[model samples]
Target: MPLLTNREIAETLERYANLASITGENAFRSRAFQRAADVVRDLHEPVIALMDRGDLRRLPGIGSGIADAIETLVRTGALPPLDALQRTVPATLLDLLQVPGVGVKTATRVYRELGVVDLPGLLAAAESGRIRALPGLGPKTEANILAAMEALRRRTGRFLLGTALPLARRIVADLQGTLPAGSSVAISGSVRRMEETVADIDLVVSTRVHEAIPATVAHLPLLSGIVRHENGSLRVTTHAGIPVDIVVVDPSVFGTALIRATGSADHLALLPEVLPSAPTEEEVYSRLDMEWIAPDLRLGLGEVMQAKAGTLPTLLSVGDVRGEFHAHTLWSDGTATILDMVRSAAERGYAFLGVSDHSRALGVANGLDAARLAAQRQEIEKAQRATGLRVFASCEVEVHRDGLLDFDDHILEALDLVIASTHSGLRQPRDVLTERLLRVIANPHVDIIAHPSGRLVERREGGDFDWNRVFAAAAATRTALEINASPERLDLNHDLARRALEAGCLLTINCDAHSTVGFDALEYGVAVARKAGADPDRIVNCWPIERIEAWLQTRQT
Candidate 1:
């Protein structure tokens, strides 16, 4: 029953369309498929449901041909035409389509003329002086391909943040149990920020058991591949195919160790500016007159500027978050029940929590309609009374293509909050999208816009919207913007958060958590907020219960 999610379908189609376009197969046909894929991926409702209702054709970008393809996939779980096309084309030629300078025609020519079926074949052809003879591909192009091939080999089997983060966490957990008492371990780098791709793994472990380093390294589970190990450091490949380096350091130096381990080389290079004479990593940030820059924000763009201006905003820390805004329960796609989600949030010392389950538009999420929403609300109210905690009832409502909300006005008004978002129709013209979002923000019931861009990082860049206008509308409407903590979708990206903050819009760092484990994703969101120069005071959820209640009430009245 778990067919490909809309996102997956869209991505596959987009890739195919791109390959087709680059190959000059049929520009219009390629564009048609690509646009349909984009629309399908962005739609809030399940594409399968739309197909079933004969509404797929009604969606923008979905013409008769694309609609037929979608219908076939929904019914058969495969696209026969796409499969046939793949069989007819060389997979290596398809891969070549991903290369920066390589085009589809070039790939086709290389395959047909030089017999380059794979990177190895391509490399061999370039080196054997056969590729340079091809039209449009000269010696310089050949050299470039060879160099790229080398880099590709090195990156092969590498782990991206999505894969590496979980493995790193498991390793840290295992190390904590085996290391001497009082030892601490944490993951650092882009993994910490929930970035999509990661170059390497950097871990900081604090332990008094120096003698146990080798044993710890040797006994580590998930080490399917090992690269090398030396000193108090061991570099190994995880079962997930990522290279990780675990560094064991003294507990007293844990903070400094973390700073050094989490460094983006470029960000570290600027350290001397703040600490012209200071010797240690910890001293560098302190000397620069700023708190230590979190590893995720070490992109080297404005850390120096903020330090010099002494106007760096106070970033949200784990303690600053007062509630969980986006969560799921047994009512929808979540694994936990409503009470369980509340209890878990309470354990984290949050003053309040918002349960914003998916609305009926998201059939894949088992989204709740009016009946289920009302039943869930009653149950939540009962849980709130028993637990003596405030639970805000909300829904992650989908904003339809026509610039309207998923739920009726009555349902929206009945909720404590509404996180209006675009789940579909993402390929709309830029102005149309802006107007759509603006209309949602202006809705009295909607409080925040979740994962504004809907990007899945590395996999796809979400639709581009007018940020200045969006922020302006948000500011005027008093609606907050979400910095989704899901490592895969850190929407309202750090840079955008900074712009939103400057524009005087309130911001919320929510886990958009679907389970108890997801509730802990707050750390990732906080890191993103900090990187964007977000101030704790400007964050709506950071406010105390009375203030938060007041803010929500303001939206209501």
Candidate 2:
């Protein structure tokens, strides 16, 4: 079979999305396709390999049908069902979704209501004032539609970090395996800096021979085509449509090339000096008379000045986290039981675990009522004795639009911790949402917020709250914000996490673990934390048992 990338698999899932959207199928059915696409698109390994290893089902969004479709695509390079779906949906109408404001529903509505089947048609409709007169759309939406169409025209080819990082790692690993024994390769550019999106992956290499590297890269398992192969650099697209650039130079110039490649253009402008013959980034920084700035801090965002001033933060590391919080069990929507969750946290060497199952408001999650909460406390006490791990029986209480918590005050005060958050009404107006969040954060019983933004990457946008105001209220109330690492919800993304920290707000980087294996996602939170310049001293969960206990006492009634 020819080389097949995960991109091919993702495209097939998209077809399902198109079909369901046009036919007005339920949201769940269309979302399955979108979710599956997200999983495959962000996956670092080729889908074909996962299919071969029988590991497809372990992924979050892949079910049996999607897995079968992936296998079919890998084996035959096409899916018959997807091809058929494409036939019903006009290709031009589907293309309208490429514009910024036009979603599947909006595109379908325009196509049906106004016979606007493409970008040009949609633009004409908006320009002629026909779009604003449609049932759901108004002037504001029409203006956005026109602007988004223009933005789409100007948009460049860039992959979201969630989609590109995994694939980039796989490609570099493949190159490392194929390169000559003494060759050295390191990722450069936005990937190294952990940008949310990037146009391409850049790699810097030092090898015994120059031509040998490109020839070797061309034959990597995922490589299907080459764009350019030059004396110093090579550009190629993986079978998954991820573009990569590899730059090879003599060992002496390797460090210089690396600094050049890892640059943000502006950062490189700060120093015309280059360090050659250095094997690592540390040496480059040392030669330039500065501390080694972390790659995430190399965004030319005043990091150089801080590096020179010796005030750069000692960022948090994976080893710093001492507890697990915001987890779930069978008491709520989670699949794991309380004991299983406790044991899993214990295995990871966590000193404490906060089991915050959902409150009774979320019917779908099987959220616990006050009686169920009291019973859960008994189980938690038993687990603490059995596992010898600190167990904090808690509830992820939902805050209603009117600023009321799911549980009463007495119930909330009795718990070890209260994680207040918004589960519904995410699309409320900014002032209303911010006020409700402020009301929750100020509650003496509330200790933390889970997935503060309520955003799911690639699936949903974050709520439109005034983050600065929320951060201010949180700082005053001593409410710790969360850096949720669900992959789908890396909320308070690195950027916002950094801003919140600067605003004197503390944060907890949590896996939001739903199952035993979900503990592995803890590292993703730590990555987001480090990228935000967060330090162990400020991350509540990274504190020692003594500090955590003392802090808990300050907040607990």
Candidate that scores best on TM-score: 2
Please provide TM-scores, in order, for all candidate models, with all chains considered together: 0.66, 0.78
lDDT of 1: 0.76
Give lDDT per model, in order: 0.76, 0.81
**How do the residues 1-557 of candidate 1 rate in per-residue lDDT, one tens digit apiece?**
44555656776677677656655567888888888887875565556567678888899778888888877776777766567667766655667755545666677688778766666677678889898898778876776666555545544433445557766887788877877677777887657655556766778777788777766665665453346766778776554345678777887666666666676767778665333333344565676667655556677777767766766555668897888778888888899988989999999998788998999989999998999999889988987987777999999998888878889989999999888878666656789988888889988889999999876554335666898999998998889999988877878778888899999999998888888988866776787788787888988888988988888889986
Clash totals in order: 6, 1
Task: Tell me the lDDT of model 1 at 284.
Answer: 56
Question: C-alpha displacement of 398 in model 2, angstroms?
Answer: 1.4
lDDT of 2 by residue, 1-557 (tens): 65566777787678677767765654686788889988887775577667778899889978888778777777888776667666776667678777765778787788778988677888899999998999778887787777666556656666666556777887778888888988888888887776666788888889978878767886787665568887788888876687889888877777778878988887877765645457676777777778887776677778888888888877778888999778999888888888999999988989999999998889889988888999999999999999999998888999998989998898888888889888777767899999999999888889999999987665456788899999999998888999997676888899899899999999998888889988877766787888788888889999888887777778865
Which ten contiguous residues of candidate 2 have the minimum total lDDT? Answer: 271-280
Residue 263 lDDT, candidate 1, scale 0-100 = 69
What's the residue-level lDDT of 353 in candidate 1? 87
